[model samples]
Target: MSIQRLIFFVLSALFFIGSSVWIKDEISPKWIKYQKEYYKEQAIKVEKEYSAASSAKEKELLGRRLASLKRPVYEVKQILLKGDYSWDKRLNGDKVDRCITCHIDEEKLKEKHPNAKEFPFDIYGCAVCHGGIGRALNEKIAHKGIYYHKRQMEQRLVAAESLFEFWSELANLTPEESDPNQRLGMGDFKKYSITGDKAIYVGSKKCLKCHTGLTSPHVERWLRIKFKTFELVKEAPDYIAGNEGYRKTCLKCHTTGYDETTGRYSEEGVTCEACHGAGEVFSYFMDIGKALEGQKIAKVGTFGTPYNICGPCHHTRNHEMRLKFFQERGADDEWFFPQHTTPYKTGLTEKGDASKSLPKIY
Candidate 1:
């Protein structure tokens, strides 16, 4: 061969070999080295086939076949800190998420829907309502990193027996003499209570951390309804002043916290886990980008949950439970209507939903 032709051929061969190595490195998952080698072998095989091609058309066909081979492309961001993140450049560079990759439909729905477009997923984040770790990339880490699922969690409650035992250390006090501050169910008993390995959901304490009485009607409304239960239960012949059956029943229809005695959680009012399922199990089975595009998935907490946050309480529990309580006590349901109502789920319920209700994060 001529000197110029030999040099050109050598350079071309080097370029081809270098490109194959680079391509394998870029695409390989790298857990196993052989997978990359397999791809390299396939590349070499194709190159050999191309070399043996007799005509320009055959070479072009081989080139097309090589191009058509399905290869997975992975895009990743090196997260140095919690604030470090990626953005979706295609949709206005608004925000970025692994969730968006799976929830394309929700992304479209949220982007396309008139009501949802204003409040994008990036702004609100999936964790607020869904209760999972938004910062995490994978299914196990993202979900496992969040706070324990309130419904399923066994929190440290001031057990009635434990309370009695402590109080018994002081004296055999009557219900009237019981200090409100020291009472098991009355005060912030969790401060004194010992947390267990198996945590269960205490009332709306988790919810009240953000949705305080100064801002919204959540705590105030709960207090009002809860007190009414006390007043009604006081009328019962078997009722003791400081004990908790009536309050427990009030929680039945009033709040969403789990009642261990009753297998069914009838009317869970608005709370974090009420809308979202337990935090630990949250995962994406498919592309999250589709979900955002308005396509729905069953794995996500919002749609996947067995209970509807509003439906059970609104349609049945709110109207039925309090009425049942009154009827059993020989009082008419009409009197209780003013005191107990079903307006809990009719309007907005979150801190962000209410004006200036959101807590300052700084």
Candidate 2:
């Protein structure tokens, strides 16, 4: 090879390596690490103070104060709230305003409420809760709600609880299911869910059943790639396949479930048990078409709990759990799946049709 060709090839190799790291890191859940530390510290400080206080009156007052200052464990500042988000706001309109400026003492809160100890870190900081100029005292600039601000701050503690409940349900288990050693559910609970179908377990076969001839960009892409779950299994084998010859590769795209008849799918693919929770319990409530009849869609669908529905699968925190793990299926890896080419599958429950609710933004 010519000297120029060699240099070009080396540079290309470096670029590929760099790109892989960036994508992996992007999918990894590092941001949560920082936020958890911050919350835990605050929670402990307040709990300690609350426990030590001898005066009941003082404790009551402290508890009230903490309740007012407490923020949600998640960072969703937009989806849950309205009004222009102005981190610059002093107190009014800004989501963060309600607590930091007013809470004279929060340490007493953590001490008083044992539940507070479960939070990831110390009390949420002033700037953390309120979006406005963190230390700014001016009301006019600080209270601005819209410009450059997040729309939701989750003022109600109940909202956080509700969100957690949704997530717990999505994992097909609850707080009881949380084992640090094992991978939980599929996505992140923090970001928005793609494709209105909150539940991805319906299987591509089901999707292809109705959408076989549907020619959309996404369909075209799937067809072009010949992205059949069975074919992928044939290409690269793994433990998910087990002694019976099934593959774990299916879990990469589908949710999980247990099949008593086959006994193999009992823990693989986008089974109903994964997103809708274990049917062993919730199956009674979920019948086809029942979700649409009610004013509030059944809790089993994506809209039932959009955040929790999307969070588990969307946010790829750990490497072993990310989608790329599926892409890296081949034994020698002679062929690699294109990172950007594979589009996520979606259905009716992901994000509701915006057109169904409002006029066009443009």
Candidate 3:
């Protein structure tokens, strides 16, 4: 053959090969592999159940399930989420999430999200909380910016500028007037953001059930002081003399799992779960004798100092009585109330002068 003809034939062959590969990929996408694996596993499980069935009724049901799994319909499963505008009036219309196509194990997901009824996966979709490119079929593209776990999601929520906008929208105030850190401390932002796994507050009683035996001294000290903050606030001259509106403001800091919009709290006073995180998933892991797994979900020993956890309420910013009292006693403008007596600030770490420390929490 002539050299030109040979080059032409080679180029044609390459073009045909490329086109075939593209067509094959389009026909059987990445998600198809995952679906096939899931169905295969399910079929094996059903087959085992069928063999172990003691009754004809159970065997008949298992046989049907096995048959259905053997010839499963493989298709792109999607959740059509009805979207709304954000705080800045950004239109977020209908979204198509194909995440469920690959993550087809509904039972496993149901276990992870015990409160699935509240924020149904079918309605709200995965991207609403565990953010990612929901519509993408390719694994790499789909999980581009995905939050694989609760801790990552919590960090994202904490760092998000949208939290400030959301807080402003909820409080009927401007973004400048709103405090995202304060919202984080009050559990208002998290309550509105997500509701499953570590997001649901399981109360301090759940924490005490385990920790009381482990760290008796710490738990006892915490119960004596932190647990009595709500009662103390109630008996205080400010809370007693103030109106209903003023008392409502105190609940934001004085109580655990306070919902600013609903005007309700999960429990009175600053509990263990308040400083840590919601204890549902954490408790689940602990109960299953998976202490290391539980620690990953729990926010134990995460906060270096008490300032981040305590500054929301203990500071002199909004405390009119405390602020005035400190000012009258010739305190500096930067000086915060409830001063630390010891060199170790709030029993967390050693500092030169605890009183000189600035409020970095908010």
Candidate 4:
């Protein structure tokens, strides 16, 4: 062979070898390093426990744990999540969550996600609650578009910019004191962030089943007025001929469990769960004869006034129009209207009248 050809072959061989090594390192990556450190720590921990072990059986168990830790499997760890929990539903198949590869401390994760039954880390995985690329191995790629806090995900669902516009428009039209920039439902959003499943609304039928007794006259009254909001809007000539934007804006306040992104609602009209919150856990507790527990879990506004709860829907524009409409039709007694002027009371009960107090918008 020619010396030039021989040199070319040698260079080609070296290039292939270097590429192989680079690929191997990339495949193993930083997760392997983390696993190695974790194993070392575990081995040290077991060794200390073994040293402190007075009983023969205890020492034996500790010795076995130490041996296992010493010979730790340093590979990419992943939880094979059941079902396609991916953001894009087009990508069908069980999701592979490689988050646990680096985040190997299961105990630490358990501390953060306390409810193992509801959101099993093995089944649902990290990406379901905390948004991220579950299948990606590289740290940056894996954590891309990750939600560090639950509020971040909730705020995304609420579509804060759109909500701000809605609130601002209502505030401008109303005669009530209002701040457009205030965070309206931060506390309310916490109830939503419990689990992905818990975020769903169970509808008013579930609530009404328990609250339908003659003793709960307040609930009956609410059903008469508030529950008729969507019907009232639909019957309105303006709403019947309104543009999509106008209809959607009305639905935001009129309907329960309205999703701004999807432009869908769980139920028509402001149902029991609308102000009380999503009724999965609450209803579950209530079903088992634990009303107090259910109330706490639901985060029901029992102590405080219903100003914050009612303010979102009971703004000046809606109040003035709805009141005038109802009164003109001789249905004013049936419909509970908001107190448009100052010293506004949220007419939640017979005693307390509904108010035109706009929700704080920071």
Candidate 3 wrong stretches, greater than 4 Å: 1-17, 84-93, 114-117, 154-255, 258-362
Candidate number of the best lDDT: 3
- In terms of lDDT, model 1 sits at 0.40
- Identify the runs in model 4 with alpha carbons over 4 angstroms from their true place: 1-24, 84-93, 160-191, 194-220, 223-271, 274-362
What local distance difference test score does each model get?
0.40, 0.39, 0.66, 0.65
Model 1 ranges with Cα > 4 A deviation: 1-21, 31-249, 253-317, 322-362
Q: In candidate 3, what residue range of length 10 has the lowest lDDT sum?
A: 341-350
Which number leads on TM-score? 3
From the highest TM-score down, the ranking of the candidates is 3, 4, 1, 2
Name the TM-score of candidate 1.
0.24
Cα error, candidate 2, residue 8 (Å): 99
lDDT of 2: 0.39
Error of 1 at 315 (Å): 8.9
Across 249-275, the per-residue lDDT of candidate 2 in tens digits comes to 334344254333444443333432344
- Better candidate by lDDT, 2 or 3: 3
Model 4 weakest 10-residue run by lDDT: 353-362
C-alpha TM-scores of all predictions: 0.24, 0.24, 0.46, 0.43
Report per-prediction Cα RMSD to one decimal. 22.8, 26.6, 16.7, 20.7
